[model samples]
Target: MIVLGIESSCDETGVAVVETGAQPVPVLRAHALHSQVEMHQAYGGVVPELASRDHIRRVLPLAGQVLADSGCALADVDVVAYTRGPGLAGALLVGAGVACALGAALAKPVLGVHHLEGHLLSPFLSQDPPEFPFVALLVSGGHTQLMQVDGVGRYTLLGETIDDAAGEAFDKSAKLLGLGYPGGPALSRLAEQGDPAAFKLPRPLLHSGDLDFSFAGLKTAVLTQVHKLGAELQARKADLAASTEAAIVEVLVKKSLAALDRSGLQRLVVAGGVGANRRLRAQLDAACAKRGVRVHYPELALCTDNGAMIALAAAMRLQAGVQQPSDSYAFDVKPRWPLDLTAIA
Candidate 1:
């Protein structure tokens, strides 16, 4: 089966083609993406109007590029898969409209994929993939959660951030330190030269003995540290950055381990943008290795929002006999949606 996936859930406009049902697994024919990070940088955050307009401008062109790169015509696509919700309504509409229109034009099936589910299944797109019934730690800019995945589409939320997500904390702290928007990556790069022990930041709720997390207080701690050090801290940005990264990584690794222990799942999969953090991956790898458990991660480039994951997810859904919505089917975007609502099998 050939599935053409469209992802416009956020600032990224992505398109891909995947051929499924092969012996080893599905094969991704071609994948293309256009990121609006540069455009949104000036605003220090995503401006919904601009995001919507960009998606409108980019989706069709990206889709064309994917088809051309894959050496397939539009009619060759058997299914049109797209992110249906959990993002900006206007931004999502662009993809949804294009997907539905394409499906109608080609007389192909149209499937609405959940964005988070796309993230959860991302690891399978890599050379090494984890089996089912694993523990998933989803750490993104807007969400931080731990889930138990018994199989595709079968998820049970174990715990999540009660306050700001870990990525949000990174960006917020970086902004305070004079870093620009999307500060997570920039701050992480600076932390490499930082002395992890230079500053001691609070690990809020680290010992709460519960699965839930809280990073709001940790950000506040960074604020207080900045206020105290004033010009001195600004002069030593690298050290401060390193310390903050270390503290956040420690808390995340500890909590994820706790979740694994509680769930009794030997396999762990890290998803979402924060899963790309070098420190987090190292700590989790070490922790899982010591415990004789396995850890899985998406290809680093796939960690952020993209279309390949969505296509892979939709292909699996089709193979599982999940029905496609009717031509009259129409649903609006959801700024917030729980993953457990949809069952894969």
Candidate 2:
């Protein structure tokens, strides 16, 4: 089966095609992505209106590029898939509208996929795909969760953020340090030049004896330190960035290990944008290696929002017989869909 996926849930406009047959995993034939980071950089954050408009301009051309790159014609796709929720309502609409329109025009079935689930299943598209019954650390924007994934569309939520997610902690802290838009990567880059212990930062809920996470307190702590620096904030920015990153990474690593121990699952899959952090990867690699746990991640390019993961997820669901595409052309989107409840299986 050939699946075409579209993702416009946020600042990126992505389109991709995947091929699935007898293989356990779907093959990504080709994918194209365009990031709106540079455009949003001026505002120091994403503008929903701008993101939606950009998606409108980019989605179809990207679709054409992906199809051409994959050596497929418009008639080849078996299903049309698009991200349906947990993002800007406008952005989600752009992808959903385009996908359903395409499905209708071609008289093909359409499937609406959960954005986070796309991230969760992305590792399967990686060079090192994971097996079933593994722990998944989904650190996507605004979400930090640990889930036990039994199979495609079968997930058991272990824990999630009580307040701010780890990604928010990084971005907010970076903002406090005068870092521009897309603060996470900028903060991490600055961190490399400073000592992780340069300033004392709290690791919130690290000792809670549960998997639930809270980074709101950590952000407040960063704020406190920034205020204390006063005139020296400039010279000390990098140090603060390092200390903030260290605290966040330590909490993430320790909790991930704890989740592994509690779940008694030796395989770990980390997905979502924050999963691309070098520090987090290094810490996870070292910790999981010592515990003899196998760890997997999506290719760096797939770590952020993309169409490939969305299409791959839909193909996998269909392959596993857990879902069926809708023949109806009338479609609606969920801007706040939850991963655990949205699975069709």
Candidate 3:
């Protein structure tokens, strides 16, 4: 089956095509993405109105690019899939409306996919895909969660952030250091130049004996340190950045391990934008290796929101017989859909 997927969840617009049933797992034929980082950079964050408008302009052209790259035609697409929720309502509507329009035009079935599920299942598209019954750490800009996954659509939320997520901590801390938009990557790059131990940062709830996470406190700590640095903040920005990244990574790595131990799962899959953090990956790799536990992550390119993950998720759900695409063109989006709530009914 040929599935075309569209993603316009937040600051990026993505499109892709996946071929299912030709192999044991679905294969990503081609995908295209357009990041609004540069556009949003001017505003230091995403503007919902601008994001929705950009998605309107970029989704179709990118979908065409994906089809051309995949050597497929629009008429050949059997199912049209789109990220249906947990994003900007306007952005979600753009993709949902466009997808339904396409499905109606082609008389093809359409499927609405949970955005987080796309991230959780993205690793399946990697070269060294993980098997079932794995623990997933879905860390992104807007969310941080630990889930017990038995299979497609089978997810139990082990824990999640109560306040600011890890990504938010990174971004907020970087902003305190006067870093530009998309502060996480900027701070990380600077962190490479200084010592992580130069200034201590808080690791919230590291010993609360629960799996839940809290990064708001840590962000506050960074702010306090920035104030303390005062005139010297510029001279020590790199050290502060390193220290901030260290605190976040330590909490994430330890919490992930805790989730694995609690669930008695031997495999771990880390997905989402924050999963692309080099520090998090290195620490998790080292820690998991020491424990003889297998850790999996999507290719760095796929770590961020993308159409490939959505298409792959839809195909997997279909293969598992957990979802039935609808022929009716009428559709609605859930901007706050929960992953656990997405369990097969």
Candidate 4:
């Protein structure tokens, strides 16, 4: 089966094609992505209107590119899949609309996939894919969660952020340091030059004894530190950036370990944009290695929002018999769909 996936969740427009064979796992044939980072950079964040308009302009060309790269024709696609929720509504609509229109035009079935599930199952597309019954740390844009996964569509929410998520903490803290848009990467780049021990930033709920996370207080702590730095902030900015990244990384690592211990799972899969963080990956590798646990992550390129994960997820769900594609052309999107809502045994 060939699955064509479209993703316009926020600042990126992505399209890809994947094929399933006798094996349960599907393989990515070709994928293409266009980042709106440079466009959003001017505004220090995404502007919903501009993002939607850009999606309108980019999705189809990218889809054509993926088809050409994969040596497949639009008529040859078996299923059309698109991210259907938990993103900017306008952005989601552009992808959903185009996907449904294609399905209607091709007379093929269409599937609406949960955006988070795309992130959750993305590692399956990697060279070293994870097996079932593992723990997943999904640290996407505004979401930070730990889930117990038994298989496709089977998930138990172990814990999640109560306030600001880890990504938010990174972005917000970087803003405090006068970093440009896409704060996480900027802060991490500067962090390479300084010491994490130069300043002490709070790690919220590191000892809460529960799996839930809280980073709002940590963001506040960063603000306080920035205010105190005053005129000296420029000279010591790198140190502060390093310290801030350290605090967020520590919280994420500790909580992840706690979730693994609580779930008694030996395998960990980290997904989402924050999962791309070098500090988080390095620390988790060391910590999990010490515990004799196996840790998995999507290829660095797939760590961000992309069409490959979306298409791979749809293929897996179809293979598992958990999701049924529709012949009806009518389509809608859920801007706030929860992952657990699709959880099934």
Score every model by TM-score: 0.97, 0.98, 0.99, 0.99
Question: Per-residue alpha-carbon lDDT of model 3 for 233-318, expressed as tens digits?
Answer: 99999999999999999999999999999999999999999999999999999999999999999999999999999999999999
lDDT scores of the candidates, listed in order: 0.88, 0.93, 0.94, 0.93
Model 2 stretches with alpha carbons more than 4 Å out: none
lDDT of 1 by residue, 20-87 (tens): 86544578899999999999999998999999999999989899999999999998989999898788
* Each candidate's clash count: 0, 0, 1, 0
Model 2 Cα shift for residue 83 (angstroms): 0.2
User: In candidate 1, where is summed lDDT lowest over 10 consecutive residues?
Assistant: 322-331
After TM-score superposition, the amount by which residue 236's alpha carbon in candidate 4 deviates from its true location, in angstroms, is: 0.7
Task: Give the TM-score comparing model 3 with the true structure, all chains together.
Answer: 0.99
Model 3 C-alpha RMSD vs. true structure (Å) is 0.8
For residues 1-345, could you state the per-residue lDDT of candidate 4 as single tens digits? 999999999999999999999987998999999999999998988899999999999999999999999999998999999999889999999999999999999999999888889999998888889999999999976899999999999998999999998888889989999998899999999999999999988888999998889999988998999899899999999999999999989988999999999899999999999999999999999999999999999999999999999999899999999989999999888889879888541
Question: By the lDDT metric, which is better: model 2 or model 3?
Answer: 3
- lDDT-superior candidate, 1 or 3: 3
Worst 10 residues of 2 by lDDT: 336-345
Tens digits of per-residue lDDT for model 2 on 26-135?
99999999999999999989999999999999999999999999999999999999998889999999999999999999999999999999999999999899999999
